[model samples]
Target: MTTVSPLVAAFRQASYPVGGHGRKNIQVLKEALHEFDDKLESDIYGTGESIEGFQAEMAAYVGKEKAVFFPSGTMAQQIALRIWCDEKGKRKVAYHPLSHLEIHEEDGLKELHQIESLLLGERDRLIRLEEILALNDEIACLLIELPQREIGGVLPPYEELEAISAHCRANGIKLHLDGARLYEVLPYYQKSAAELCALFDSVYISFYKGIGGVAGAILAGDEGFTAKSKVWKRRHGGDLISLYPYYLSASYYFKQREPKMGQYYKEAVELASLYNSCEHVATLPLVPVTNMFHVHISVPKEKLEPILVALYAETGVGLIHYLRESSEGVCSFEVSIGDAFAQIPKELLKRTFERMANMLQ
Candidate 1:
């Protein structure tokens, strides 16, 4: 391991105390609470409060007839898949090999639902429409991530997305979107969340991604689908007696921060373009289509961690993350831009990277 630099050490110690992960909006939250307490005090935990109001708002936002909130995306998605499998009488779901379904969710699809995943798509690219069309008969539903995350937020083209969705519809295969960062992609795609979501039978969105909710996910679809999902939610142990805090946080963020997604997308492209100009920084897909991009640093293995620690310490700017090894000494990592990154001085980001690169050399 290489030694940590003093610059990196200083960066880590500087803390933006209020900001949490995923670009939180503290001001919006405060306002939401004041309103919640004033009009929603006794109805907290969804007892007498209008749960349907939130659901209806989410459904409208995503262009669906109904929406259901889950404590977590994991539960919401699993239940979505389970419902699809039951309805279609097929026990297979097709998704990218790197999708949250296969990578993040611990085989619960198999263990809990006994459904098999027909994984497609290469490690570094979008899953092709042909891939889904070929397996159209076997798959009960096709789960598509807008920008595939594991490979650094690569998105399929709109035409390709429409083609795949059409294939699924033509074959009677349900389409479910694993849109954890759906808000991030809308700005880049020049489409509204509802417009993008209209292609699928069910769409799931996270309140904590670009929208800045503390933690919660909404699964949107038709009224019938949501009604069925409630049953699945109960079966999977996701139903809560009260979801007030989650709703409070989710509604707070959704109303305040969701509109800023376009700004985040615009900033991400500029950020990626800046890094693309750097000599040592090579991007995964060459350009970011959403608010997330990964930078591959060609530095010695032993030097990587020290540089990361150093960078975090010096400028309090979180940069690229090396999740795993790449070919040669180069390590690839992601840069997920959010509200904090929005507030960060561009010169500071530039300086941090410049210093780190000099350290490596």
Candidate 2:
């Protein structure tokens, strides 16, 4: 038996959306399970019809020669960088300072792969092409996270992104896209996944982030890259015996939600506009380019957390799960619009922000 914290319990039982789909209930689980009721099982080592079918579909979706599924994005991306480093005989890779590989993966690349990270650009801004050009060191790869997540989902201008990609190509550096939130930004990019992927040597996307899968990631690249990745995947213990459930959920949601991301992006813009209008709340980036953005509240976390919890209790609107306090004592939280947000009327969201403003004052 396991014990759950009171806040965790409240979030789980909350009737409203609490950030992303982290609080999926039993009914939702059963519905997703029903989707796989009619499907046959995949192979023990990821060779069966369902797994191969999803990988092929994703490869075609991203315009890659091949795609391999990994149990986690951490494994997929580290392996991708390792492969590029091994091929080029350079241990250095450049990326934004806030990149997941740098900030979130707990130095796995440094410890496991012996890869050194060259941090590029300032925090909370898109990496400029001049920043890459100024680097004098030899590097095997340049990892770019489209709509960089930690910086309120900001993206480099399309022209700048193209320039960077061109520079990487001219310098013989492999460009890999950490497109964990790729689907959410496609509408803003106004390009198909394939078109964006065409610029990179490899791309990594998460099944659970925007795709709403159980848990998995797809690393797509040329056939040789994917073949080598498969071996590394096994070496890294990501070769699960049965990954059919993740495959089925990813396939189902990719079809169901990928097509409607543009609508979600639009909704996010509308909601962000309303939030920005509030007196005490401000959205980072000032406007949203994708379906995700950061919300900063003037109130301290000590006060804002309870207000949010009470608001959910009284109005059945779970605006956020928790707040991350900044150095200045202001609290910031992320808003990721999805099916849950699509259900709420924009007027109601506006009112919610207004009410929050009143509470903070």
Candidate 3:
């Protein structure tokens, strides 16, 4: 395990830390496990009601005809791409240069499916309609991550999405959504999950992100697509003895927090404003479009660590302690708003930022 620095340790001990719901632990699993006792013997592999029912419920939520649960988004997405590539007879797909498959997956799609990825757009921006216009049907699918998290959780305008969708549909190109944080972007789009997902041919959503679940994913699409995914899932050995624990937690938290997305977005904008007020600190997007944004500080991580440690000690409210050096003499980190943000007293939060402004100056 990567050891957290003293700054992170101080933030952990702070009276109010402003990021995420809380430590992801067994409590998250317990939060949704009230109904299930140990004697549920009917559940075998994924035949349980929780697992099957969640897949159906999420299918409706995301406006798909059918859905299947996956142990991980990596497994689900690779299968989604493989299905598309097989149907289109092209072993190639396209997505952002910094796509999870491209950077984070250790070439799972390439090694497992023999599928090639045509990386689209610059490293620091959303893939534009023009980029899609330049591609032919040679690529089997195009994956768009809502609120491109790497670029500060930024999203392209809805109109741009419409144009891209139209072009992809007209070109025999399947559109896949990497919607790990799909629920987080709902407030900014001012659209329902179903409406937003309508633009994509297939969608993958994470339960652990903004939903505060234990861990799981849903791959949803038309009947034919999802049926194929189920076959691929079995081929990939995703069928565990029972996934009811993950399913129940995902369903529980989705109900608990889906409605709170707007509130989280409001908190994110407010939080970003406070960061912008501090010298040497800025949030990408200037204003957050969703419940998350990247915090970039114009100070080296080495120098900023002690300052934040001191701040956490002096102020009861912890602002931020984790830091990632974005460039020379600069550092960055991501913040996602949830239950913890509301727990921080408003007056203390304001005072903490005021102290931060002074310290950064």
Candidate 4:
């Protein structure tokens, strides 16, 4: 563990948020809280009419016939796959090997739903059409995650995305989108969220990621699909007695942070390019398609951890801290930027990162 000196302690006090907190106008949250407080009656719940109102707005935003809110994307995604399998009378779903469903869900699809995954695509890189095309016809659904997160936020090109969409449509295979970071991809795609969402049969979006909500996710599809999912959601024990807080926070964050997405993309690209020029740093994909990218820096394992711990204590600059030990015994570190930290001066951050690299050498 790295010890924090007094100098580092002072720097920590001067650093910005490690998460999205005061990044927006205080009045926005004040009004949202006021609305939340006004609705804090007995049960603090919404009728179908009130729930439907929120659903309608979200559906229209994503160009879907209906939308349903769940406490999490995990439930929404599982429900989506279950619905797709039931409709098509198939048991297998195709997705990238590194998909959140496969890696993060603890085999819920297999254990709970008795559904199987085909697990197509490369693990370290973005999965392409040839990789997807190799799958057999037993697949009931295909899930595509825009800006694949685990692989350092890489994405398939626009034309390739279109080609895959076309293939799914012609084959009668249901397409489900894991759009947790869909908002971050729009500026580069030059398409509205609704337009991009229209390409899939079902689209799942998280309110907590780029939107900065406290917690919530919405799955949008045709009215029948979403209505069916509500039952599955209840079956899976996801129906909440009250959801007004999540709704209000989601709504507030959506309204406030959605506009800054374009600026974030610009800054991300600039930062990635800057890192690429440094001797010790190489950026994933060499450039960023969205506001999120990774800085892969080579450093010695012995020096890396202490420097990182010191940097965090000194500057609340929280970069992604993971070290992989190669056969040669070298360590690689990554820096990830989100809305909370994206506004900091990119040049200054890059300089500090380079200085850390020098210390390791």
lDDT (Cα, tens digit) per residue for candidate 4, span 120-141: 7678878778876655457889
Clashing pairs in 1: 8-310, 10-313, 11-312, 11-313, 11-314, 12-312, 12-313, 321-333
Which is superior by TM-score, 1 or 4? 1
Residue pairs with colliding backbones in model 4 are none
The C-alpha RMSD of each candidate to the native structure, in angstroms, is 3.8, 2.1, 1.4, 3.9
lDDT of 2 by residue, 96-117 (tens): 9999988888999999999999
Q: Candidate 2: misplaced stretches above 4 Å? A: 1-14, 25-29, 37-39
lDDT of 3 by residue, 134-207 (tens): 87899999999998999999999999999989999999999999999999999999999999999999999999
- What is candidate 3's CA lDDT for residue 343? 95
All candidates in order of TM-score, best leading: 3, 2, 1, 4
Which pairs clash in the backbone of model 3? none
Candidate 3 vs. true structure, TM-score? 0.97
Local distance difference test, per candidate? 0.76, 0.83, 0.90, 0.76
**Segments of candidate 1 deviating more than 4 angstroms:** 1-11, 15-35, 38-47, 308-328
Candidate closest to the true structure, highest lDDT: 3
**lDDT value, candidate 4, whole model:** 0.76
* Model 4 TM-score relative to the real fold: 0.86
**Per-residue error at 223 for model 4, in Å?**
0.9
lDDT of 1 by residue, 127-158 (tens): 87777768656778989987888888888888
